[model samples]
Target: MFHVLGALVFTLVGVRDATWTTDGMAAALLVAGSIGVAGNVAYGFDSVHVALGDTSLVDQAGAAVLIKPLGLFFPLTMLLCAVAVRHVAPRWAAVVIGLSALAFPVANIGNIPALGVAVGVATVVGFGALAMRPVRSPSPATPAASAAG
Candidate 1:
């Protein structure tokens, strides 16, 4: 559920940024973030029930050692970004919700597959949305004739 929610946030942010900003780079970031969300979801779908040390995709010799560390650092990064972008678009909502998703993964350090998915979705969605906002257009001026009359 958290993973799904994170993906939703990411998509919404991407769509918002693509629509509002002229910066191609921001749009690209959103795209990358979206991909991240998709990847996380796929990972969850493939292996959500395997118990630890029972042999699964991540059971490859050094894989667990390498990947588990990511869980530790990744959440910190996400939390930093969330804090750093509080003044930005999507603001606190994205930050808070995203942090919520990170709770499980950070706590379990990626040991819990389901938690990993949750954090992945939440981070992308929250960060992606925060980076983009709708552009506002100025109102047209009233006619001179109307004002003079």
Candidate 2:
């Protein structure tokens, strides 16, 4: 249900952007939405395995590790946009990313709108701060350390 809605949102956004002059952001959104739809499809197919306890521990561990990062992708992408594109407004990018992050957890947990908005606002603020930070370069090691045997 939520997955379907997300897919629709992505598809619509992609279509909307196609008419504009924006480079690839809309395409990326469409792809992300498609991935979300696919993820939900895979999740649905796994129901039998989940019910029968037929899955492996390794698979479960890998899935658990993947989940957190999967959830973080939206926020991360917004941050990347802020850093990579000079024209994009960081605040708006952050808001969209935040909304996406908010939507997933809330939708997964069966809550909608409220949590979605909250997560969206919070994520935007957090990432916005991150966007403002200056890029730092790694320091060169001393010659003494470089010459060590």
Candidate 3:
């Protein structure tokens, strides 16, 4: 998913955030969210077969395992990623990422009188491009290192 790829851009930050807790938590949330998304899609497809009065107990179980991980874990992952990005990237990159995140959801309002989903998606693509730079944060200056150089 785009969100996960976007999150990976913050890996350097996640590892170097002066705390291992964030890195561990981000990894946990990423795995949980990914599993949740895969499972949700699997269950959703199975549940769809129940619509034509051809319900099976196994297929019907989709309703039970549907929303939790997707609703809870995925957003948490995004939040973690956003926080991670803030520490490593410039302020403007943070703003662009934030805008792109918001753009995805607003894109669903396709029939709105003024703006359309296309505009929203375009915003995400454009802003995401601006935000995703390849460089990691430069190492901090140390007296010995600076003197040596």
Q: Write model 1 residue lDDT over 57-115, tens digit each, in one string.
A: 34556544443343344344344334333433454554565576458455454467786
For all predicted structures, in order, the TM-scores are 0.39, 0.33, 0.41
lDDT of 3: 0.44
Error of 3 at 115 (Å): 8.7
Distance from true position, residue 143, model 1, in Å?
A: 28
Question: In model 3, where do residues sit more than 4 Å from their true spots?
Answer: 1-22, 39-65, 99-123, 130-132, 138-149
Candidate 3's residue-wise lDDT over 14-42, tens digit each? 33332322445556645654654454344
Per-prediction CA RMSD (Å): 9.7, 13.2, 8.1
lDDT of each: 0.47, 0.44, 0.44
Steric clashes per prediction:
1, 2, 0
TM-score of candidate 3 to 2 decimals: 0.41
**Could you tell me the TM-score of candidate 2?**
0.33
Per-residue alpha-carbon lDDT of candidate 2 for residues 1-149, written as tens digits (9 for 90 to 100): 44345434534433432222133554565455455444443444444456677772226775544544344443334333333232223445535554555465555446476765676556546545544754232123422223332
Model 1 residue pairs with clashes: 10-125
**lDDT measured at residue 69 in model 1 versus the true structure, 0 to 100:** 41
